[model samples]
Target: MTSIPPTDFRSFLSSVGRVFAVFFRQGRKARRTRFFFLFSFLPVAVSLVIKFNQVFSGKPGREGGYLFTNLIMLFYLQMIILILALFYGTSVCSEELEGKTLAYLITRPIPKAAIVLGKYAAYMAVMTGMVILGLIFSFFVLNVDRLLDPSLYGLLGRYLGVLILGLMAYGAFFTFLGSSLKRSIFFGLLFSFGWENVIQYFPGSTQRLAIAHYLKSFLPATSSGRFSFLTFRLEPTKPGLALLMLFAIAAAFLALACLFFSKKEYSLED
Candidate 1:
């Protein structure tokens, strides 16, 4: 049974803690969880294929850094991160609405913001765990020979940091949309696949409007060294600016999501 806590700072924290644990355990049994676990390892398959092909051609060497930057990073930053954020992030509220459980949720004594905050934190933990495990295994497959190199670990650390920031920003933005918009999934697809992909490649400062632009700023290089022109970045945002902008985006969206969730009324029929 759900705990009924009075609205206060301590009660709010208690609400968030309880909901976090409950939702986290629920998420484990979710089909989305299984999908993410499987999706995370997809890159490992590609890594093996590439490694075998390189070895057969007599061009194999410990080029994990280059391979990651040129090939795998694109698969990750452009595709995997976006998919994860969109699928899981938007589900925070959408799932409740679809399951017809939001009514029961809001009627409880717990603060509404706590529901959003708790669920967001729970999803973050799940996404992070899946992403970290998948990315680490993928990196291992790519850099099998360089596991002892200290620099390799640093590279992995930087990559993880950048990707996590991407998840946080994208996830929060989608969570806000999910709570506010009726057709958030449609808009999310447009935003993720349409706006993000195209805007980053646009000419001039217009490209700066894209979240991908800021993300690419922190990436050491573009998609592929040879075909880098495909996803070129003429003037990437500064690392400091990227950090600021991403954090600001996440915080702003989360605040909006919480506010909207707290105030908006939903009917059982709607």
Candidate 2:
């Protein structure tokens, strides 16, 4: 029996460290990262202003303030996540191809899956950070004059879970697209605006084809009473089913992305 050398452990740790280091360094260097932070925070700021004005005026009853606030915040946050994920996910592998740096990275002993996972982990960290910041900001805006209701906290927990699931699903789908197509940006834009927008409004089970349907179901109806016309159109699903569908969509997309990434040929010449 051949004995493995002690150096193997050291090598493994070193490789793991390198993966994180590379992911952070490359992610920071990407130009769109600034835009990611900016867009992510802007909505939170605007919500704060709106909430402050309402609280001072003592006129929060008109538009279902609570519900409208929650929906708008969540909607904007989801949009930011989707857009950023599409940009970052595609750029992770696609940028390497464009720069002709992939060959050098692949030459390292590190598995390609590790590279993908490492970048994905880093991207998610950034995304989650943005969401948390937005959440905190929104909380302050919403609860500055009053205590948060315990029930609202529970609802927030549910919303956060769904937000994460939505991110994973969108991220994996875009990563696969980015890896497979040189024109991923155009196609991703179309899917976000054209496909998702259209499918969300379709009647009945047809809406199930879009991830947004499951997400909207997880959200509590707007409470502000102002945006009655914009309340969630679809009937809410049981929490278990909503969660299951979200995870299922995320898992399927992530698996497909991994499969495509593992076998696809990436070239700078494209």
Candidate 3:
């Protein structure tokens, strides 16, 4: 694409469109796609095995609801969601850099931040679709008996909204790490499973420092002992404030990622 006038709003959008188109098309072939595709089906596999035990005993009980909610939350919120966002988000820039393709993109006439925005949007699209499909299939497998329940669909929608929001907040923050750190996944793990997990247990307002604090506020408090750590000694932020804070966190990290990408001199060697 030729260089459009930098001040032209329509032209800038057109540039973003072109970058988004290129990235979205190629993103499917990424290894994360295949890995997460299997990872998403995990709950389905677990649900089937557990449910089958009940069936083989000729005692198909009402345990599906508890099993579904428990397994899904444990797998996705505690594990898959964070890992998905970590790998894909940090790879936003790192992938191109390691592949030595960043030069080709930077050489284009488009604004550098447009590269970040376009690629971020494209990755989000791919990740969201994959995770949701997994969530849906697992939901169906676990809750096949309740398919017609009106409230079940509403509950599904709530889970979808929360997962997507978590992806955005976590993905953007890790994208910043990708832009700034060569070994971002290490720190991503530390932050996601360590600080984010541990900080929520701290008393008073100090728990608010972790991103999980805001995301967990949107989820219902569970009574299960396994996940009591999530709700134990926690202060819930209002949903409105939590939503706003998540958006703010995403925006701030994304902005910094863009800024650093635009200013820093990255080399194929580095």
Error of 3 at 176 (Å): 0.3
lDDT of each: 0.83, 0.69, 0.84
Clashing pairs in 1: none
Those runs of model 3 whose alpha carbons end farther than 4 Å from true positions after fitting are 1-7, 60-62, 224-226
The true-versus-predicted C-alpha distance at residue 255 of model 2, in Å, is 2.1
- Please say which candidate is ahead in TM-score: 1 or 2: 1
Give the Cα error of residue 220 in candidate 2, in Å: 1.5
| lDDT tens digits by residue: candidate 3, 1-270 | 887576687877778788889888888877768888888778778878777777788887655556656668778888888998998899888888898989889888999888987888888888898889888887888887778878878778888888899999999999999999988999999999899889977888999998878878887777665656657776889999999999999999999999988898887884
Best by TM-score: 3
In model 1, where do residues sit more than 4 Å from their true spots? 1-7, 222-224, 227-231
Question: In candidate 2, residue 64 scores what lDDT?
Answer: 25
Q: Which prediction has the highest lDDT against the true structure?
A: 3
Ranking by TM-score: 3, 1, 2
lDDT of 2 by residue, 29-73 (tens): 666767777777776676666776777788864332363245445
Q: What value of lDDT does candidate 1 attain over all alpha carbons?
A: 0.83
Count clashing residue pairs in model 1.
0
Q: Model 3, residue 265: displacement in angstroms?
A: 0.5
Q: Which stretches of candidate 2 lie over 4 Å from their true place?
A: 1-21, 28-31, 55-71, 222-231
